[model samples]
Target: MTRLHRRQALRLIAGATGATLATPAIIRAQTPSELKIGGMLPLSGPAAIEGHQVLKGLEFAVKEANAAGGALDREIVLMVEDDEANTTRGVIAVRKLIETDKVPFIVGTYASAVVIATMQITKEYGVPLLSGGSTSVAATDANEPGNPWFFRSWPSSVDQGLDTANAITGRFGAKTVAIIHDSGSYGYSLGDQVEQVVKDNGGEILSRDTYNAGEQDFTTLLTRIRSEKPDAVYIGGWAGDGAMIVRQATEVGLRTQFVGSGSMVSDDFIELAGPASEGFAVATLYEPSTPNVYGAEFGKRFEAEVGQAAGTLNSLGFDSTSIGIEAVRRTGGTDSKAVRDMIATGLADFPIVQGPEGATAAFDAKGSVDFPNFIAVIKDGVRTLA
Candidate 1:
């Protein structure tokens, strides 16, 4: 096999068992126990793209971990639930994941609002919720020691705003920009970040536009933005709505270049925005298919296995499982705390998630990984690195 294919095949294994090398050098054999991890994600709804990815990743991780004798030598039973992304339905889904499934270690709720609401319930039950999605600052910060079981894997929108703004400033050398938000927490947070980033980088803002969620119309907003003709327009919203805005913006002949977050580059967004989505730029975590030494292998394997493309944030859910299972083999346990502690402390040199050049995946103090951020622009109806 070619080196790339070999790497792809290896990554496709998603297990850390049967082979001595794949097993951690430190972890010895231990008695097996039965433990379950809950996966709360949007199986249906506007945000289902992310939900499906999280579910796949969780399942892949659990399978590999189990093959490795489970985390802490306990079987990692998975309990899956759909949050639906609606306020009430999200709350219900998380509650069911915890109470009904009796899963102490639950991962879920991709939307910030859902995470916020569900965190309250998880906190009440003393269950550890390592969220696979939702990067709103609220996920990590309630400023209370009351609930320590919450953690997030994605970079906070606050930090992303700064990163994005800096990137924009460096690229454009423009002095002014406009902010557009979808009036949702995720969109607002992204706009807020971009606005701050623009200001920080010596760029002035002309206006900040806000719209309601599920809005398929953007002629007014585009007209206003087009009239002002800011150097660039920064929009932050999920793929579905963002796609609509992009399509409308193009139809209205809005001349400004668009910059947005990763949520604007999903299956739903791609399908909805169609050709209008092209040429828009975004900042995101992973890019699987982008040509890179490390990620190229995994990227190819991902496509071969799933029969679809993976993005720069480059996981359709299996990456999480791969990392978790490897951690289990290394720590020799399935205990939530044990797996968590080992991942936090011993995962420095680990290579579970791959990124482009010089990109690493070490978890920071907040128990989040060092994900890469790439700027991708739409070209001919596809997101391509700019």
Candidate 2:
């Protein structure tokens, strides 16, 4: 079954408590009592695959929390809206989630552009937005010295590019590189960062290319890049596009090592690229072989529910949602400001599953976390730590 279908089939329904009337007349009235959280995600567009994994991660965190008697002594319900990765649609979803659904906070959107667009809505309503995806440094910069309503649990593009560039130039000893990126905010930001890093380290950039997301043909670009004879090529796009690029590169006999952002470290990339994915390196925050206690448990749950091992995106969702729930539990209520403050100040030692060994979730003054990014290479169709 597809992950979307599996999501529908494996829905874990939470029971709600009913309010009882307390009066001398002894008239008992019942009302459903639950805490509602919002998710604004791209469930039906180019970014859907990324969004789906994040949703599963959000579900995993909620499932665990509810099993342990959820936050504020209430069962948590996740209400989601499909933004389709469009800024206008994302804003509408954010407003509806805040005004109509009355969700205490929102989580889980993959595209950096969408997340950046909806930030204003969440801020206007004083609702906290815990982002599990979207790594563009621009997203965090808007939050500046910490915007009260936004908290990012993902590593920034700057961090990912720095490490990946270091891996290409320092480790693999590639002195000349070609860069390709999509036009989206996340992709563009990553490509820019990687280019800067490569130049800073005294590497020569042969060429730079940009394409829209979901573009089919890369033959022309690959042929052009091959002519430049760069030592390595860095892809700053999503898995689907990355897979196609590598596959076409092989078809054109453009023999160069492939390195990319965290988005390339996925089953989708490997399965789509087939033999071409071999030797593909990516910089990412999570490695399944090295999981903390929470990560191990999350991995088992993800595999059981999603029928696949938890990857970097899933880990991102888990940590982001887990932190929000923990904040609400500590706040003793769903007051948005209280929850935001608690997350900003009280989560210094919050344990999470995504970063280095024994890693804990903590936000900097810019409302961004400092997660360690490491290089992983695909060998024999398996993503193994390098």
The numbered model that scores best in lDDT is 2
Model 2 global lDDT (CA atoms, 0 to 1): 0.78
- Report lDDT (CA) for all predictions: 0.64, 0.78
Clashing pairs counted in every model: 12, 0
Instruction: Give one digit per residue, the lDDT tens place, for model 1 in 1-386.
Output: 01111111111011225554331122222234676667777778878766776676576557656766766557878877777887777777766665556554567667878877777566555455666667788667752533244555445777667667776777756577988887778888888778876786788999988887767778987888888878888888777777778788888888777777767655556677788766777876666555555556666766676676666333525555455555556765445455556655565555544445433335555545434456777777666766
User: Candidate 2 at residue 197, lDDT?
Assistant: 82
lDDT of 1 at 312: 38
After superposition, the stretches of candidate 1 with alpha carbons farther than 4 Å from their true spots are: 1-35, 62-77, 123-126, 143-148, 289-294, 312-316, 327-334, 354-361
Clashing pairs in 2: none
Predicted structure 1: lDDT: 0.64
Model 1 vs. true fold: TM: 0.80
